[model samples]
Target: MATTINEIIRDSLELIKAEHLNLTPDNYAKVFCKVAKQKGVIVEDCQKVDKYTKKLDPNIVTDMKRFNIGNIDELLAFLVAKLNRANEGDALKMVNTLATLTKRVLQAITLLHDTKATSLANASLERLDFHQNLQSIDLVKEKWFDFISNYDDSYLKKLDAFGHVTKDDLEVMVRDLIKILSKDDSTELYKTLVPLIIASLSPSIASGMNDELASISNELRNSPDALGTPALQQEIKHLISKRIDLDKAEVQKKVAALDKILDEINKKILELIQSSNFSHEQVKVIKKDLQSINFQQDSFETVQVKLLNIASSLESETRSLSEKMISNQETITKLQNRISKLESALLVAKQEVKEDYLTHVATKRALANEMNRVEDAFMRYKIDYTLCFIDIDHFKMVNDTYGHEAGDVILSTVGKILRKYIRQVDFVGRYGGEEFLVILPSTELAQAIHFADKIRAIVEQFKFLYKNERINVTVSCGVSQRSQQKSKDETLSAADGFLYKAKEAGRNQVMPVL
Candidate 1:
């Protein structure tokens, strides 16, 4: 029984180390939970153990008395208590609360630092220092207090507008702030932050417009020309209600119409001015005729004043009309241009959805679709097809040693190499994680293996870099031909089996010994 306990503990720690996971107290607690559960034991309040200090040592978790479980028996009892104390959901909630509070304090510190509020930044950092000395529950409470106290009224109002603050809202705000921070303009930080907060108040004006436009389209399809239909006169009380939501092309057309309206208004106003000159000419003739009839001075002056006032009022009204027309035209043009860009972006996004964003290759869903197509061609036409599964060796170690950003760079580089080297007739896709699939149509195993070995050799010799540091990497591939397999699934299974064989025979080599 002691030997069983020792082996389990050793294997769990080794697995965690192999995965390159941080051997923090929380991770250690989790390991204990796993082993205890395996031994048919339940641990309650396991989160309590997670509160232990995150001291960096892979050995500490497996053998420390600081976690209050020095022996195997004590470990089992502790695990049972931890697991049974509360549900996993409650534990997750606690963890999220801690994370959110910590993030908020960090953001406050950043904001204060940018504003040259050195004193405030120091205080915030001191509070964090103060946090480390306290218990986990107290640490969380301290962070919350620091976060709420640090922000001013304006920031609070923004938070309030988000409506009953939650972790999700904080996460959104944090993500947006981080994006803005990349611009590195500290002067307009608050200015930028405010709009982002308000923008999050709803689904988005453009998205709402899209939905309204779709609804109108549906309504028209059911009864064609909904506005012009006489039967629905009761529904739309006004003869010309208001601006209706429209698509990009329709918006551009409306913008052009608005431009015409502006031009016509300007022309009519100019024509009105020309007519005023004619009116003045008529007034002069009237004055001459009145003088010939010996009219009174006071009467002539009064008539002239009335005509001048009328002309002045007409000119003022026309000027206002011209301004409005120009303003409306400019607004419509800008909106139309914005809509065109948005539609173009949406099209690109839809295309990207079908591709593996990181790899720039077919996504898993797309690969699945291609697999079905290839299988159909094989079954119907008896065409030969081969598939190779490729996996990167020691990918986790690369991530652990260099960082996830470096891992991403390496993955993208590998993807680029695969795409560049493969034939146009063959299809390559990211199967997921560090794995890729190369689907060869009308090709035999011999041909597939040759291609695999070539790719393997290229990757082995390829010089990869992440942050100016050179990194070496290799791939192991399993090649299989679809000859006797009953279906696509069976063929893939055989390919996976060979891929594992490649890994077992020492990575950086292809399967089937050649």
Candidate 2:
């Protein structure tokens, strides 16, 4: 009996899912290439597809009989038919054909979500590298360790809650961008393992026990009730214990290396905390803030969300409390005014009872309580905002032509422009060189896109000066909005994919995904 097409697609998808591949365009090509080799489907021809597909050009399969690269609708229909016919013996042959078809469709969709994941990884790393205050044992061992450990999909999920990215979004996103300085090709293991490690750090993007994982877990289960629980529930704990048993020597070696780093950071923190020249009150406040900024998780996304939320809440609460205190302080002004009036009305009215300036200081304690409330609220709502990633068009050319100094000026100038256009409450940060990330609290994608367009327009019209030369700049933007229960990394990636299209379609445009 001949195998059906849908079955082939299903099996292929399962294979990808089993391997935790994100169905990226590049990975999709790889999957097809693997399938073709296994089924002996003109491996050389498949290699041609891989070569052309990697370039992301559309002419790769112009002559392939099974593929209709021009009509996505027709191609998808045929691919679906092939998927319905999947079987173990002939599955690879059909999947290879479907892969060529899907690759075209995906290229149109773009899969920059992997890129976004990469971005988040870099952002989280920046947070770790620049934090500068890791002085206590708790901060060093607990906070930093936890931040590094949990830097996977969960971070993206939290960002999604903030309305930045979504899950399984059919768009190209740039995720997990690790900077590779070393040229040794022997680093394939390092390259592959690094992204996986970074992805794992973000619990949001990390694949949980899917059907394939479930099968593996079932084989390892010791109890009849194992079916009820996911293997990931005990994944970390189990891995730790298993490593202790199977690779005790390796664990000890890493422990010795890690201990040296921890001691150095702790010593630095202690020195700052114990300085005799600093005021006792200042030390107390520093300690208090340090205690509040707890880093219990190993994921950078987790740490960033927690720390930023806490800091923002603390600042907001301080502002609110200060406002109220100012209002109360107005009463003192009124009383002082009244006392002046009495002195003017009566000759030598005994220098009106001396005002006690210290009385107002009591408000600080009350303000602390209000700050706690604000911090708690912030923690709840940090993930409830929307975020957009914006990339500047031909920014490198600007840098290369104008030099890094001029590039810095351009970046600073752009930052000011974005700040001016965006709402003061919206969070805008330099996502790195030539890229900016914006977080909109309580705003959806449609509203965000409108804002993005405004930024694009303002940027296009703006001119920068390097010495006497006038430089005009424009930007290409991709806008992605997060769905209610999706991963932020994927959503950001989708927006990034749109941005890529914006560039491809021509620079200086806003391409927002619906």
Question: Residue 340 in model 2: shift from native, Å?
Answer: 42
Best by lDDT: 1
List runs of model 2 lying over 4 Å from the truth. 1-384
Q: Candidate 1 has what TM-score?
A: 0.36
Q: Which tens-of-lDDT digit does each residue in 1-514 have in candidate 2?
A: 1253344445667889886567876566566656655655544534553454455434423423435332334445555665685565687777566746644543543334456444444444444446544353224344434544654765555544333343454332223111122234443444333322222222122233233333333333333333235674466356434434544554454455434433443443344334424323333443355445433323222323433333333334333333343346564355346434543543221111111122211122232332333233224323234556677778888888989888878777877777677775565655545777766654677888888888988888887799989988888787765554255556667877888888899878878544
Task: Tell me the TM-score of each prediction against the true structure.
Answer: 0.36, 0.29
Per-residue accuracy of model 1 over 216-289 as CA lDDT, tens digit each: 33444354334344664443332112223323445565446435533443444444344543433443443343
lDDT, residue 221, model 1: 33
What lDDT does the true structure give each of the candidates? 0.63, 0.51
Q: Which consecutive 10 residues in model 1 have the weakest lDDT in total?
A: 197-206
Q: For candidate 2, give the lDDT.
A: 0.51
